[model samples]
Target: MAAGLAVTLATMTMGACSGERSEFDTRNESFLNDASPDAPAPGPGCGHQCSLDGRSVINTCTGETVQTCAADLACGAGVCQPPCAAAAADKSSNGCDFYFQEPRFEYTTISQSCYAAYVVNTSMQPVEVSMELEGKPLDLSRALYRAEPGSAEMTPLVGPIPPGESAILFISDKSPDTPLTPLESAYLGCPEGVVPASYVGGTPWGTGYGVAFHLTTNAPVSLAAVFPFGGASSAYSSATLLLPVPTWAKQHMIVNAWEMFRDGFGPGAQIFAAEDDTEVTIVPSRPIQSGKGVTGAPARVPVTYHLDKGQLLQIAQNEELTGSLVSSTKPTAIVGGHACANVPTHVTTCDVLAQQIPALEQWGHEYVGVGYAPRMGGEDELMMYRIIAARDGTRLDYDPALPAGAPVTMSAGEHVSFPAGVGEAFVVRTQDADHPIYLAAYMPGHGAAGGIWTGSDGRGDPDFVNVVPAGQYMSSYSFYADPTFADTSLVLVRAKTNGEFKDVSLECAGTLTDWKPVGTRGDYEFTRVILSRNYRPGDSFDGGGTCQYGLQRTKSDGPFTATIWGTAYCVSYGYTGGMALRKLVEIPLDVPH
Candidate 1:
């Protein structure tokens, strides 16, 4: 999808190839020296899936079956995947192994949630995925687990997540049909001119767990954690798609937002180790809370500790941890955010914020920023964005021209904030791929600057989202949408294939009819679609609301990016639906000479 930057990797061979020989010449030479017409006919097996007839391999993708690889594509990963998919993080999320951390979520009052995971089977064959909890107190009384409305049940599910169907593994209550509310939560929306929890500096009063789950990722599947129930379990509701352990790395930077009141936890970074005796180090962007024996961590000072497999440690304090660097003797995953936060320090309503931080290596230099759907105000919504530099002298340039007030450069570990208005699509890029940057989109508190902006979801609060860069997009995606909020929508950015825009479709909504063209930096475009709205909280999963939450998939002839957002009264959660955590190189289906 990043045609402009991607084309560079494809051109490196040219410098020493002016004397290149044609395919015919190469073939002639091979024929002369290694002719073998007497050999037997070629077999039907593909290289990776040799057991299956390459002529009729399983599509593996949703709603598709047996098919041969396209002429230019090779059969891999059980289907005809572009050569580039071999090393990208897109398909990596569906591996047969995954390690998930049951994060520490805090609230102001009566905080209790059905901690669960929404798992979607992305493989063709049925797979029995199971879980092994790392922490105890493993009591399963009235725990909700269901895949269909008519077949709701309590206790652990009998079978797998099931192919083509989605399953919610609830940790409490048996409500396959409904979610909790804020007033129901005995919670209050953040008010303007209020002191944040970080500034006020108090201990976390909300419920939090130190558990971890080792999912037998057998068969391909993708997962997302719905904070509590899919509903406004805590109008402080927030959720994020979880990346498989295979996509995690040895390094990560905690991306934090403005903190909340002193009651809940302030800006923090939680690190989970996958191996025993993993020596973890944290260079805090702010003072670190003394917890779990990490007693003397301070801002800018590196702290080291050991964690066995399945153990998690949260380092938090009164200051933000946005640029903190987390390194480990082994690969680890870091979930960063405030238990609840004001998007900007000067905002009103606060919302829970958290996202699995991608390893620095997975960051990209190019991106397209889009705001969450605008259901609260029929008009296009505005978003605040942050560009974090992973390397020094990271210069940023905006397509069509840099927006005023936007910084053109940033230093390593430094970040800049800028506003992106409605109905706008702009391309942001660094000098090259080496200067990768991380992008985070933010929704300011509804009562930001003391201005009233309330509607369908009530008085919305501040929220944070990790923006998936164009360079990390994959052709197809199978993600989850929480049906607990009043509204849910998607933001998609599509890049051209062979110099022309290709169509992208959402499972709930067919072919997209509206797309705003991104500048002339290359052939790029973006669109915002509201998947569901005006639905009562917590009823979508039970067939009573306007939105049905579950396995939501999207596809295009070429790679593209997608993000999902859910909004409730004074509450919302947003996260990129999926992305390829960069690893391998170029992805040109048709590499040129």
Candidate 2:
């Protein structure tokens, strides 16, 4: 998950559910504390020791150690208690203690026709989990399989899963052995046209697209969706995405576009409306290079569409949609990337790259744009960043500042892009929150001297990714590498002067190299974690490799941002390379006491 960013509150109602309820409360409520004015103040001679464990704080003062309440509880005047249970008899001297609820999970891509869903139990206790299809719960006992992390096999999940394990679920045309019961079909609005096996050249979910689902568990879990592409005989170009939490959704969004991997081919946008009866408006900031209705000219028109709960809209276009704006009456989820993109126009191979876009409201004013390792032969990689404004008159301030003539003013729905120096990291910020803006980074291909460079006439397609905002920076995150990628690298960022790196930890299913500070932008510092089959403890290559697969988890003492970069060779050789940034599922913040 990216870190927690401040959000404006807008009250909305959700229907209740039957059966076992989730242990977590989805409601956003505030807590109040009553502190006595006569409370004694600490004396100069009084020494204090304080530390945080999860959401709880441990403080040693006046020769005694006391643990404060969990994050959701209220601690005031040195007394800790659940905000609503201050007067309850269960209250104890240590505070009204309780377990923190598991965070809610929100997935943007779910289709029985093309993909499979996996959930990892990230907590210490066993948990029973269930699925909700389009807001309706399914039989918790049906269609569930469990597997250990990194395992290739799955068995029926007949009972609660133990800690540190995971499970898989599917959605598709029901089979005789895994038939969709009439009740389940009704809830999913199934029996639609089955996706043909030849769809997307026989990819896993090619012809049989199914309904999206929401998973609920008794404990926090990590969610992911995997799409195997490049035909059934060859699942070469596969893509994996980390599911986001619904609470992170906002009403506004902007996605950058690039030339299709091939000249005639274009990129596709998979948009999912997270809420019911949602009205979504998609405005094209630029014209479509190629598509059914597209002429040779650009299409600068806006299109509005409606979605029933759980419905998905897939749009493919040849021209770039960089400045496009997506606004919904309610929160929505979006996954945008090319089906396959050729980096340098001359290269014959291409890879799939897609990521869940965070809502615009989650966008922050400050950001540090970082790049992946330089291409082989020390060839400089070009980095381009786009700043999208959420409101009119938003002003941008840059460090290593923009070239003298770059524009600084951005109007709502408008976006501006500037080139970042080769192998350089830079910081950009807005004047205040009133002018929140989203930032995106792009790496251009074309004789770039890397794993997979393709282009024609010196023109190549660029890889675009949403840069994590400083406000959304988190202290911890868990992400997986595309099993199909030959090489992968994890980029980490933090305040340049912060020595919290000593508190940082990185664990991978495979080997993980030590952290190396790669660059700095203003007061922000950056580092890279190399993960590859050929990486050795003392290796100093430019972060490249093969078969870089597995889950990677990271944690640090202070707020920081991280993203994964993966690349492969030409498509003819069965390699398609691209990168996807991960967004964090936040732990709810404790109210101020």
Best by TM-score: 1
- Tens digits of per-residue lDDT, candidate 2, 53-147, equal 22222332353446655644533334554432321211111111111101001011211223444455544447576655555665645456654
Model 2 misses residue 458 by how many Å? 17
lDDT of 2: 0.43
Q: How would you encode candidate 1's per-residue C-alpha lDDT over 204-305 as one tens digit per residue?
A: 332122546666544556677655444553556566777777677777777765454454546656677778888877786677666544575667888777
TM-score of each: 0.74, 0.61
Best by lDDT: 1
List lDDT for all candidates, in order. 0.56, 0.43
Report the CA-based lDDT of candidate 1 relative to the real structure: 0.56
* Candidate 1 TM-score, C-alpha based: 0.74
